[model samples]
Target: MTDTPSKYLLNVDYGVGGVTTHFRSRPLGDDLHSETMVLNLGPAHPATHGTVRIVVELSGETILDADVEVGYLHRGFEKMCETVDYNQVMPYADRLNYVSPIINNVGWCLTVESLLGIE
Candidate 1:
């Protein structure tokens, strides 16, 4: 193995007659081994505007990790966009973010405009 810094090293000891082995002892705090709860917060609900699910892992009252899943609304954004005319995609973009939908619309418009070399 590559040389590791002394501070991070754990010494190993081999027992006589190939019977056993031992490693240096290090104490990990209780939280390291504690269980975490997974909480799922919606693809569609009053509190979160619908179309995204947030899964959060909690240790007691503290959040240990969070994962976000989007597009529960539909699966054909790309295919539908390909079939529609340029202007037709505007309305679809507006619905991307229900909370601040106009932002998504404007951002999509700007991107398309820039790509077409329209100033």
Candidate 2:
């Protein structure tokens, strides 16, 4: 039996002839030793279905925390809109949701109409 310097003390058995050993940690800090891990899913991975990034924190195979990022597909969408006239911006809006572009087009129209106080 030996003690290792860690958050939890490890009990290890060194086999005879120094061939092999087995070890396990018994946490000294808390009654339940919950080790956490952080995972980055991606802005380019297929499962996400789009240019999005996810940050996940895990503890013992359970999710402890998560965060999401969107819009890696078109970073210039907003910037390009700013450089164009309102009517010209429709094309950019349509591209924002290419899968169902009519939704983006209608949403942009509603936003513009509301901003201009048009019925």
Candidate 3:
């Protein structure tokens, strides 16, 4: 065995290990006297228009930032569609958006008719 150590061991920087990770913990206030507050708008509350959750960072009623989270209406439409034929898919499409079943029914019928034409 040689007396020399590896060159890679001497090239490593020792100062990087001493550095501290810094992060801004809170929202910056609007002005010198104003305060910032975090408001969780909804997981089920109104004005969301649908099943959406939002966290709003506000400074005295004026919004600074907003984070929106969706997935509350987690119906597996795509997966359900895969297991059914075109003629059998209309009712499931209605369930995906019940308020617009007529539109869904019409679209489904049109697509099925088009596909049948090519066959």
lDDT (C-alpha, whole model) for all candidates: 0.73, 0.74, 0.72
The alpha-carbon deviation from the true structure for residue 5 of candidate 3, after best TM-score superposition, in angstroms, is 49
Residue pairs with backbone overlap in model 2: none
Candidate 3: residue 69 lDDT (0-100) = 80
lDDT of 1 by residue, 1-119 (tens): 65653442253442245553222234578646667666778777667776778877778899978887777677577887899998999887876676899998888889989999999
RMSD per candidate (Å) reads 14.3, 14.8, 10.9
Tens-digit lDDT track for model 3 on 1-119? Answer: 77665456366532346554222355456444657766877778967665778888788879988877887689888898899877678888787655567887777778888878943
The worst-scoring run of ten residues by lDDT in candidate 1 lies at 7-16
Give the deviation of candidate 3 from the true structure as CA RMSD. 10.9
Best by TM-score: 2
TM-score for all models, in order of appearance: 0.55, 0.56, 0.55
TM-score-best of 1 and 2? 2
Q: Across residues 1-119, which tens digit of lDDT does each residue of candidate 2 receive?
A: 54653443342443246553222335666745567766788878878666788888778799988877776565588789888899998878877764788998999999989999999
- The residue-level lDDT of candidate 1 at 42 comes to 78
Q: Is candidate 2 or candidate 3 better by TM-score?
A: 2
